[model samples]
Target: MLVSKSAIAAVLALSCLVLVKPQVADAQAQRARGASAAAISYEEKKRQTSDIAVTIVTSGITCTCARFAEDIRDIVNDLRPDGLRVLPVLGVGGLQTLEDVLFLKGIDMGVVDEDNLRLLKKRDPALFANIEQRVHYITRLYNNEFHVVARKEFKTFEDLKGKKVSFNLKNSQTEVTADAIFGMLKIDVERLNYDNNEAMKKLREGEIAAMIVVSGAPQSALSRFRKEDGVHFLALDERSLPNHDLGAVFDNYLRARLTHEQYPALIPEGTSVPTVANRALLVAYNWPESSPRYQRLAKFVESFFDRIYQFHDGSRHPKWKEINLAADVPGWNRFKPAADWLARHKGALQSRDGRTLADLRPAFDQFVANYTASTGKKALSPRETEKLFIDFTKFLESQVTSQSTR
Candidate 1:
């Protein structure tokens, strides 16, 4: 009680110190709690790492589907910050990829031959009854030509009747299509299941009459295959078939050509080999819109469609030029996200029926030139040139408008 001024001041300071200590401690404890809550758990860390990743299971490396996947991996992956990561998984080719799509865990997408689904429906209707609901397509990617390589002596597919022919690996796309096609054509051949290399070897030795390979033109395995070995791609023109009827074959397959440019060794210059082709599909699971998976897939569709045109500019794959972003795939429902995208940006790149203006400019120019020449006009007049250019742009715009309206 008998305190000097300094003593009283010291006592006051001590009292203040005592009161502030708990406040400092409470602030430190609150900060520590906040830090603890902010720290991410391992499971959540795993999810954040995995959420951006989408695994696309495709056919063998030799198959064009894999080539397409590699293109996606090269272009889609590595987008910094906000971009998606595409992981390409190489799988057994043909319909097997379909199984992977429907059954395998962590497979976000697959590249499957469209006919594979049809074959599945045919083989077991009950098993795949709800397949259409479960699976959906992003787009019809490209066509895989059905190649029938045979010795020079075997001029037509019929000549190989009752002869040994390799149908590639059993249950492979080649075999599945070959089996269905041959059976439809009513041609009976001694069926053999061999991979492309083995089939080519046997074909060279005349052990087999022909080997069927159903894949994109200039398929990696066949591109290097020597024509000097006396084997060539047999013309699968409608006329070559028994009764000249390809109506049945056209049920699921489209008429396509193997051009000389694609396979310089297999096809002659300025000539093309006529063949039937099965369309390859980029398919995904039918994820609901409310799910996180759907958001991820939608991100993919937007990013891919946005960057798709670059793929045609000669950097990615030659097959990219063949992709028609607006092309409708028969019998397969497009993924809701992909469909919604197309609906919003209809004819975003395509002009007429899936052919883009870039794809038609050359042909259109040639037609104009030929028309002028036929009319005895040596060159397009200044007025004509301007008119043609306007018309060209107008035509593409008109197509885009027409599609968007519908």
Candidate 2:
């Protein structure tokens, strides 16, 4: 066989390719085996740790942290016997932390924003059981109305147009919520990132038109601003305020009115600080069957709801009484353990599976009416109020379970 130079080169190339094929095949086979083994190990690890973790994330150093820590201590104590360890997890940053944790496996539990439930569920339906099952409505949190306390001139929302405003931080829930609230009034809010103290300094120096501050009621800033600055409370009508959807985003919030008399210095006897209510929920995922601690914790939550008023009564705002455990608010269905306990004890215990929304309306409406009548300042005596709340919590357990079964 007389071969041309090209044919000779082709033969050499083919011989080399044949020699390398075994090495390549061996490498790929080894990689495949390694991958399979790694996957098995990961799955086993997940199974081992799936039963006994209780992690929590909170907005650090903020006002809510103190109360949340106290509330969770009681919850953890109740969850004993399951060997559950409650630990603080930093860097949740905001509501997105809830979504991030849902993607992680074997974690067992953590808290999240009730408003972000839709977004979280879209990522993993199995991760979150239902709107009511996987979540619990712990308390009603309020977003204190912080007005841009000017000397006297910055009185109206329209007056602040084109002016520089102070914000707590750039991406803070405070700023985002503020933008939504102010956006409705067509005010072009230019937020400058400064700490609360610095923001106040800027306002005093006339370097900023006003500052936005938010906290629960009986806040110190309200007193300081009123006493020193003689600030005017900016009024917002529903049509003029930002975040019309706040009512929907916050399950514990009520569309209540804020009159100026609440803060003597900030608002004259007649000033109104119109703002939306904000809610902070106690959130967690499913409790593993193997963890006895989680079961105990579930029972604690039920009992705590029965007596929460003892802890929150008369210390701060009277509005705490209005926070109900059984109210059917949008997106509270993510706290699976609490929901299960509520449903099982309140509704399903009476029947085989669970009660539907259709079965719960009449009772739910009565709850609402009674809750309203009980919460007003003039409505119930202290002892009567306590008993009413106890009944209300019981009803909420039933209503939520019934709604979820449907």
For residues 1-406, what per-residue lDDT tens digits would candidate 2 score against the true structure?
1113343234333433443458788999989978866776766656435444455554434434334544545444323223444555543323454543444443334433344555446556776656345444443333333344554587667777788887666544456456656654456867787766787777777888877654445445444564565355565544544544434323333344456555666655664656544544555554564665456456545654445445453553543544445555564543444565555555422333454322333443454345446555233344443444345445545555657689
* Per-candidate local distance difference test: 0.77, 0.50
Clashing pairs in 1: none
TM-score of each: 0.75, 0.55
What's the CA error at residue 262 for candidate 2, in Å? 4.2
Candidate of highest lDDT:
1
**How far does residue 290 in candidate 2 sit from its true spot (Å)?**
4.6
- Candidate 1 C-alpha lDDT tens digits along 1-406: 1113343234333433443457788999989978865896888757666888888997667888888998877766744434588999988777777878888888889988887787788788999888888889998888889999889999998898899999988778888899988987788999999887888889889899999888887689888876688988888876666566777888767988889898888788999988899888899987778987778888888767655654675666688767877788778888988887677555434444566545554554566566557667456564454345434444445546765579
- Deviation in Å, model 2, residue 29 alpha carbon: 62
**Weakest 10 consecutive residues of candidate 2 by summed lDDT:** 1-10
